[model samples]
Target: MIKRFGVSMEPELLDKFDSFIKKYGYKNRSEAIREIIRERLIDETVKEGGGESFGTIVIVYDHEVGDINDRLVDLQHEYTGLIIFTTHIHVDRRNCIENIVVKGKNSEISALAQRLRTIEGVSSVKLLLTNYTYK
Candidate 1:
């Protein structure tokens, strides 16, 4: 069920809201507002349980560091279902870039990220995500 309501606000507030929504590429104020509410609700839900989410994990590391490549391979194989695919680039003789596509329960993804982040030669890790249902 849907209900409509009228809202009254200062002109300055309305102008700012319009500008903000425009920057976010929203077609209309109502849809933008609905998305804002949904994002908050999803975050709250994810906090309480392992909500289904999908994200990419990108990492840059030195492949030569203490058999880091094999260690990473072992860890990735351990989480079979979480990783959809992984791409590797030999950035240099020693440096490598790896991007992993992942989808799983929130906790499982987070744990995989944590494990990767803890490895010694991992110079960088970036986790970009949207709750699977959102995008």
Candidate 2:
């Protein structure tokens, strides 16, 4: 069953939320709010630790940098049990983007992300972690 509830907030906050909704092209405030709540809950769950999760670590780097590409592949192989999918894209002649999809406990996934960030050529790394346990 679906239930509706009232939410009260300052006028300034409401105005900001309306602008955010418009920027995101949400059909209604409820939809935007629902997504925000779900994201927060997932964040909490992931932070609490000791749970299985599936996530992707996306990294952008310059392929010319000191044997970094080989190092990245070696690191992924080290955690083959956690790694499920990998996609590599060439952004330019010298630059590339890689998305490594992994599944494992929160700590293991976080460790993999940390290791990737330490690679010499990695310009940026972002870990998008979420649990398959969530429905």
Candidate 3:
């Protein structure tokens, strides 16, 4: 069942929200609001170490850096239980980008991302954590 309700907001706040929805390409306010709620819930759940979540860690680094590739391989092997897959791309003669897909408890995945970020030769690192569900 779907229920409809009314929201009361100041004109300035409402205007800002409308602009946000438009900027994000949300089809309607309801859809945008629902997404916001979902994302908030997921963030809370992940922070609480509630359940398994999926994540991807992207790393850009200089391949020529001393033994970085070897060190990365060793670390990945140590965390084989949490890693789903890894893809490597050569960005240039000296640089490479790696995407590592991981699935496990949020804390574990976060630990792996943190470890990668601390590596000596890593130029950039980002981790996208999600508890997204498909139904």
TM-score of each: 0.73, 0.83, 0.83
- State the weakest 10-residue window (summed lDDT) of model 3: 126-135
Separately for all candidates shown, the number of backbone clashes (residues 3 or more apart, or on different chains) is: 0, 0, 0
Candidate 3 residue pairs that clash: none
Question: For model 1, which pairs clash?
Answer: none
Score each candidate by Cα lDDT: 0.87, 0.89, 0.89
Off by over 4 Å in 3: 1-10, 133-135
Name the TM-score of candidate 2.
0.83
Candidate 3 TM-score versus the reference:
0.83
Candidate 2 to native Cα RMSD, angstroms: 2.2
lDDT of 3 at 84: 96
lDDT of 2 at 95: 95
Residue 74 of model 2, lDDT score: 94
- Candidate 1 residues 11-96, lDDT tens each? 99999999999898999888887888888877675566557888789999998789898899999999999999999999999999
